[model samples]
Target: MEVAELKAIIEGLLFASGDEGITVKQLQKVLGISKETVDHLLEELKYEYERRDRGIMIMSSNEVLHLTTKPEHSDYYKKLLEVPQSSRMSQAALETLAIIAYRQPITKTEIEDIRGVKSDRPIQTLVTRSLIEEVGRKESVGKPILFGTSKEFLTYFGLTSLDELPPLPDTDEPEDINQEADLFFERFNDELE
Candidate 1:
């Protein structure tokens, strides 16, 4: 492949990697190129971004490369972070929030079990909304991340503490469990509105 095509591929890989960033070894293996070639391409891409005055730029740390907004654009990013929450939560996000709120320090697997579906998107939404966070890791194998409500959750719900949450009614039936969750979501949404 041409040098230009190699640089483009490296740029795409960096962008797609997001915050985790792509390691030098990973890039070399994927492109089937030598480490020196990957390093040279990355430096060229970095210089091009700087020379062109692009809004986004390539960043490297500890042999990992990722794309990030230029430092000069910090003001714009701050404005975005300060934007008010004008949108309502989706049903899946509401359900995921309900599960996390009630079951403190729960793992994704436990949340999925309760919701009866993959909860990755909903969990990500909750984290983005600042309603939930990774409190710690479970002690079992793999030590999966344990999520719990953030202080933002209390502020959003107008509760001073988790203890202020309404008591759940007792029910033994499997169907009642889902109904109870829906009820909690409805009540929470009603209060917010």
Candidate 2:
């Protein structure tokens, strides 16, 4: 109801939106507020973050708003990513990476469809770690970004080329999704060790 409460709610919405981000229209609808109020709240929030010297700031891209780390802090972020402990990938990240490594230039939606779960965080982690990158945009609706393995991927996996990847097992037999994921994990883990 109050301006402060409105701003706080908007902040939470932005955070929960993750990499996909929230649009002004969506925010307005969610909060039952007008576009002008949403815009004012966003600008005020941005100014407060800047004035408060916060690590994250509000960013707008293609009409979507997200809470993103300040670009000036990129050096620290890069170092954080380089830490040995951070090198270990989660099962989801490994699954997403395997799909991208094999498929090459695949969309996030496609990856999610295969994994049967949202791949945003895994994709973000892979991109931040430089193991995957935006190879190009698909020609379909929205021209969604197509992700592919980066050169760093090969280096990290100790491979000179993608040709070094092991062949996939035959899919002629209908298998459970978990079985497929385990197969991928086992193959990659063997390669890693």
Candidate 3:
């Protein structure tokens, strides 16, 4: 196929893939092209968008390729797509989810330990929402079920991979605990509104 045709096909794949970028290998396999050809096509396509003033561009991030609006266009188009509404969790559920997202493969007891509260309700809510799942059985005294975020979580969070999750501070503690709590509750209250 001509380079123009290859670029068009790759752009189609990227647009259809949305925020979850397609991988280079996947593109080559789908297009039945050599790696070098695919790599060259991608660069050409990237340049084409910029040169033509196209609103969207192809991007490769975390081994995934996707067509997305150029960053400057985000404020203009964000509302048009209505980025999927991730269900707002209660304070308890948020705490539970934060723990799971940060320390996945964690058990119920561990969550309870961190929160100093029962996790049954929050765990059930997260499970019902399909945010987390039983990853595997931990080889421990009782073989507790380990839980981790699912692909849905990745899509919901607008992440191509788990590595996209922002690194959290080392400690959850605060000598100025009250200030942090106030800020959190303020934003949490805003979301509720």
Candidate 4:
């Protein structure tokens, strides 16, 4: 493939990697390119975005590459959070928030396991909306970010603290997951609406 096409493919790969990001080694393997070539292409792509004054740019952190919006454009992005309609969380976001609220300092993978769905978007939304935040990193391989309810979360939910959160139902038999979720939502729906 041409150099231009290679660069485009790299952009797609970075975009798909989301917040987790992709490393140069991973990119080289996937693109079947040398490490030097990957570095050169990344630098070229980074320069092109800067030269073009694009709204998004490539960022490298801990050897991982990510496609992210320019920090200079943060005011516009902050405005998105201020919009009243945008303040309302989707069902997925609410569910994710609930999980984090109850299980403070949990990893994304754990959240996904509990929800039984891919929760990247909802996690991102919660983070962006200031309801959840990276409290720390897990003490495991890759050290994934650990999320917890933020101060804003308590205020948004009209709770004095996490202690005010309703208790999860206890049962002798295995409780129905959907029913538990419904109970949680029923209690919080007033705050949500």
What C-alpha lDDT do the candidate models reach, one value each?
Answer: 0.84, 0.85, 0.75, 0.83
lDDT of 4 by residue, 80-157 (tens): 867666345678887887778777889999988888877999998888788899999999999999999999888876
Pairs clashing in candidate 2?
none
How close to the true structure is residue 133 of candidate 2, measured as C-alpha lDDT?
97
Per-residue accuracy of model 2 over 1-193 as CA lDDT, tens digit each: 9999999999999998898899999999999999999999999999988954689999989988989999888999999867776345787888888888877889999988888778889998899889999999999999999999999988887789999876766665323444564575557666665
lDDT of 4: 0.83
| Candidate 1 lDDT by residue in tens digits, 97-145 | 8888888889999988888877877888899989999999999999999
TM-score, prediction 4: 0.55
Q: What's the lDDT of the predicted structure labeled candidate 3?
A: 0.75
Candidate 4: where are CA atoms >4 Å away? 1-85, 171-183, 186-192
lDDT of 3 at 21: 66
Model 1: how far residue 5 lies from native, Å = 3.2
Runs with alpha carbons beyond 4 Å of true place in candidate 3: 1-86, 172-193
> Which pairs clash inside model 1?
none
User: Lowest lDDT 10-mer window, candidate 2?
Assistant: 172-181
Q: Per-residue lDDT for 1-193 in model 3, tens only?
A: 8888888888888866654568999998999999999999888888888965688877667877778778887777868656664456677776777678767889988878878767877788889779789999888999999989888767755669878655545555732332343345346446655
Query: Each model's TM-score?
Result: 0.57, 0.57, 0.46, 0.55
Give the better candidate number (2 or 3) by TM-score: 2
* Of 2 and 4, the candidate ranking higher by TM-score: 2
